[model samples]
Target: MTSDGVTTSRVVADVARELEIELPTLSSRMASSFLNQIPALQGDDAVTQLVVASTSSNLSTVIDVLQHGIPLHQISVPAAAAAHARRFAQRELPVEALLRAYRLGESQFVQWCLRLLAARSLDAAELLAAVQEITSVAARYIDQVCEHLVDIYETERRLWGQRADAARAASVRTVLGDETLDVGTAEAMIGARLRGWHVAAVAWLQSDPSDAARRVESAAQLLTEAYGRSPLTVLADDHTLWAWVSGTSRPRLDEQVLDRALVSHPDLHLALGDPGPDLAGFRSSHREALKAKAVAQMSGGTTARLTRFATVSISALLLDRLDEVRTWVGRTLGDLARDDEAMAKLRDTVRIFLQTGGSFTDAAARLHLHKNTVHYRVRKAEEIRGRPLGDGRLDVEVALVICRQLGGGVLMR
Candidate 1:
């Protein structure tokens, strides 16, 4: 080492040793004062205790750095302070609260240093140089510590957020994956009971995945308010949310209220399950809600946006066997699926015709088409299929319903 470097090290070691002698008194005084004066650091809570403990440990580390001649940046203060900062962040303490404590603690440590120098009765020249060096190093140390702590605070904050989301998703998955709940563990995780009637829902963003979770959270809160009961909500992915509202009675989720919510968030789509009671009910309801969501997405219309499981149960079950369904649609609809626009008109006419018990006038009125046009399309449709429409009315009606619900998209190979 250079001569100047050796001399500086010797000087730092001597001053550090002297400071170490005062560490006990300094730590006690600083703790008592910071706890009493800084409201942020003054509680009997676990986090507050952590703050007190970290303060004392860090003070000793500062004194050791001077005694050992270690570079301030190389010292352990930043890492130690960062660990404490993460805990504070988790406890929801404000960053300002912690920064304020550091400022106050630095003042106390400097005062203690001045008192220690005076007690030793150092020569005026030596004391002046020591005070200057100590103050300069302490300032730099605190600044570095604060910088590192802030970075760690932000990083840990994001990590904690992700961890919380993962945990919540896992808990919700567990509930839906099985027929029974762990009762205490599941309830503790979700803050809701599984022993009551539950109306489950699956919601998703139609596009723009950003802010999807915010939409899900908003929808969950809306359900909570509308039902007058708390809900268990979990974001299953960036685009999807699974939620269930609980009550002794079923939730109606009034149509007007749903319409208002949809108006507020046009990109959001919701599918609700029929209410069922208890643990089995919770699982069943969620499954149905998911199925309803699938059918709604396949159906492709604004009216399908807020579908209920009870409305689409049969179609949803059929859609579960999609390959078989495609075959059935091909055989039954035959050539009716060929002309997209014309096929849609004929299918609608047939659906309404069958729905009205085969009244051509009523079918035309419902479709806004001429009665002759309905009859002509029906005959044309029958000719294309090479079968009389009345010979297989029931089969044709079912095929038409599937065509409407699943859309031509599912029929195109």
Candidate 2:
């Protein structure tokens, strides 16, 4: 052995002899106190094993540091940390609980060390050196173990989350696909039934469509919370989530629930499908949400974060013959299709006027305008089109409806 090794071995042996009687009791008390402080460390065999392994490894590290002047890096603390973290990950325990337990153990160990120094009645100079040694070694050990464990925990957690997500996505694809899979089997896989009134919703971010998958999950979680039930959720991509809320008795989509969800997540864009019954409803609902999403994009929907397929069904179907619809709108509205504040205000007046069945008084009340203002806009609209309302009342109403739904797309403005 080298001279250094011989000296280290002698010093370690001396300290071991001095603490031999107290070491077992000290370790047991420390472990007990740590577990008491972190009850999450109990209730599982894997957790118990991790606690035991960590306590023993930490005790060995501190003793070696104080006695042989061995470095913290040379110890098996990293392996212990990795093992403990793996156990926590497997048991699906929050990493915070493990970290809290470690902190508790650290405090208990320091308290034990201080008590030992006081009981031994060391001189002032000896006490100072001992205190310095305990503090330095304890700090280094705690920091090293925590750092190693945290890294391991995060890495393990990310891998686990990715695997779980991939598995769920695959199952959802199977159920949504045309494959001849049994509903029960699919339910077992996705943890939700297909035999119920299902209202499917797709959520995404407008700024970054690629962020769809992650943002969609947040949107789905918000929906689940508002509905007061767990919904079947699947990430269609990084920026899109498809989810369904169901009831045994066909339930209608509650507007208030959707309103609350939108209020909470202002930036989230949600497209919802009409509720349908049974497995066919499950497929149709998602299909309808997809259609609604497409129409919302074309219409330049402002304040349309929550687009319902039922509400947009007419527009979504009309979008199929968009070229023809645009031509018809141009012919019917003529200069009324102009994109400006004045034209927009005029169009609103005409729309409300027609909707109220040519009642100028009602249109004025609805638009919060005077009766003269509604009458003036209608005459102006007719003059711009070069025809009276009687000549093309049906065509004018249809054109106005198209403009309202398609916005600038059909208006060519």
Best by TM-score: 1
Candidate 2 lDDT over residue span 18-63, tens digit each: 5545776666666766666776776332355457667776776677
Which window of 10 residues has the lowest lDDT sum in candidate 2?
A: 1-10
- For candidate 2, the per-residue lDDT at 324 reads 86
Q: Cα miss at 359, model 1 (Å)? A: 1.8
Give candidate 2 misplaced runs (Cα > 4 Å).
1-163, 179-191, 209-215, 225-228, 301-303, 390-392
- Predicted structure 2: lDDT: 0.71
Estimate candidate 1's alpha-carbon lDDT, on a 0 to 1 scale. Answer: 0.72
Q: Candidate 1 has which clashing residue pairs, if any?
A: none
Q: What RMSD does each model have against the real structure?
A: 22.5, 22.1
For candidate 2, the per-residue lDDT at 332 reads 81
